[model samples]
Target: MIDYKPVSTPMSPKPKLSLTSGTLFDDPSKYRMVLGSLQYLSFTRPDIAYAVNKMSQFMHRPTDMHWQDAKQILRYLARTLSHGIYLRPNAPLALHAYSDADWTGDSDDMVSTNAYLIYLGSAPVSWSSKKQRGVACSSTEAEYRAVANTTAELRWLTSLLTELGVRLPTSPVVYCDNVGATYLCANLVFHSRMKHIALDYHFIREQVQSGELRVEHVSTKD
Candidate 1:
């Protein structure tokens, strides 16, 4: 793929990858090797997190379509080798996280993809994109699950900051695009729709009530 023509993006706006859609790859070991390398690259290239995570789901039995997706990432990297994450030393210490989810985006399993970006002032410090553990009943449910996951990450970051003697002036703010999810977090009422979710994910509400985190609604376009 070294001399392949460069593409504009790492993934298509409408991807067709699925467990049953493509022919099985003949060499599983080679596919895993390349996938592993890309996974490491994702530590700094948050732009490719969704593509990398999508392809990784097929590591056990990669197909030609999977290899095609991997090559697209390489082509994207080749076209923009000079671009990478930059952190600013002068950025504020206040932690803010933006979280979103693609409801039932997976073609095969119908699982939602949860994503979050953690920023210190204007600079991003951590981010993640992963498929959810189970199927969500509604778009709101998917978004709520993403909030739960982001809240867990915020808890860890808060602990780490405390250990480093860094003081946060106020509760860490979490921004989500889904109004229903934000309302669910802010309200204590356990509706029938929310009973299916595990008790552990409810920690986000506890943190909100205890003043450890603040969940807010943001526009999806932002």
Candidate 2:
């Protein structure tokens, strides 16, 4: 696993997300090489993981259009290379996670972008940005899918901590912005409303019921 630098007290300032999306690059091979570098850099810069991963999908036959997007990530990195996870001293260390989904975010496949942000105490340690497995019938289902994915990540991390002899202080807290999904998780109800969701998703409901992961509704901005 990559060890990302953690920040606690505010240093200079949080680096702003670079606004440049993409530009024009002529060499297809160089474009592929640059993409490789950015993907490795994502070990320290998780915020850009989604954007960089999206750009890498076009590498085999990268167009001038694809090259522009790769450069855009470089520009964003240029503006925020100094940033990483900020872990403060003497603060309470707790594991908390937040999940969200962009329903049908992709116009082509109509797949949702399932992502989560996880904080170890005041600093974030783990996060993921990935495409969901199937077409969700509703926004609630999409968000629930994201929560299930994030729950798996939490379970794996906690297991690693236990193997390393690190005692976890509390049950991991998982916050989702959608309330209806929260109900879906707790109610244990089966209905046409959720028929499209895969059967494996019940894993989240089980974890929630057994108290391995606590699901709570939080403000979307958090």
Candidate 3:
């Protein structure tokens, strides 16, 4: 792809890749090799992280469509070679995060995709984009699961920073786009819809009650 035309985006928003969408790729090894390199690239180029994660799901049995998507990522890289995360030494030391979910996004399994980006002051220190373990019954459930995942990561980061002698001035806040999920965090009344995910509910509620974490609602447009 050295001389390929550049693309503005890594993956096309229209295509929803599935496990069995296209014919088998002619060269499986090549597909895996290229995707493996892209996985490494995602560490610095978070713009391509979701695309890489989506393509990586098909590594075991790559199709022609998957190969084309991978090439598109390369094209995107060519267009934005200079883009990367910049860390500022004078950035604040507080921790805050944003969590989101695409409910029933997977074409094959109907599992939701949960992602979170945690920022330590100005620079992003931790982020994740992956499918949920189980199918969520509602959009609220999916969003709550994402918030739970983000809270767990924040707890770990808090412990690690504490060990490093770094102190945060305030409790970390998790910003979620779904208002219902945010309410679930602080509301003790358990709705019947959320009973299936009781474990996750209690786990996050414990942190909030102890003043270790805070969950807030943020509009998706923000």
* TM-score of candidate 3 on Cα atoms, chains taken together: 0.95
Q: Which 10-residue window in model 2 sums to the lowest lDDT? A: 10-19
What C-alpha lDDT values do all the predictions have? 0.88, 0.75, 0.90
Any idea how many clashes model 1 has? 0
Clash pairs for candidate 2: 6-85, 6-86, 6-87, 7-85, 7-86, 7-87, 22-68, 23-68
Q: For candidate 1, write residues 1-222 as lDDT tens digits.
A: 779898889887655788875798888788899889999999998888988998899898788878778788899988888878677888778999999999998978899999999987787778999999999999989999999999999889889999999998888999999998998997877445699888888888889889989999999888
Please estimate how well model 1 matches the true structure, expressed as its whole-model Cα lDDT. Answer: 0.88
Per-residue accuracy of model 2 over 149-171 as CA lDDT, tens digit each:
89899999888878988776778
Give the Å shift of residue 87 in candidate 2: 3.4
Model 3 whole-model lDDT (C-alpha atoms): 0.90
Model 3 C-alpha lDDT per residue in residues 1-222, reported as the tens digit of each score? 889999999999777899998999999999999999988887777678788888999999999999999999999999999997888999889999999999998889999998989999988888888999989999999999999889999999999999999999999999999989998888888555578885745689889889989999999999
The better-scoring model by lDDT among 1 and 2 is 1
TM-score of each: 0.92, 0.81, 0.95
Query: Which 10-residue span in candidate 3 carries the lowest summed lDDT?
Result: 192-201
Per-residue error for 155 in candidate 1, Å, reads 1.0
After superposing candidate 1 on the true structure, give the runs of residues whose Cα lies further than 4 Å from its correct spot. Answer: 190-192
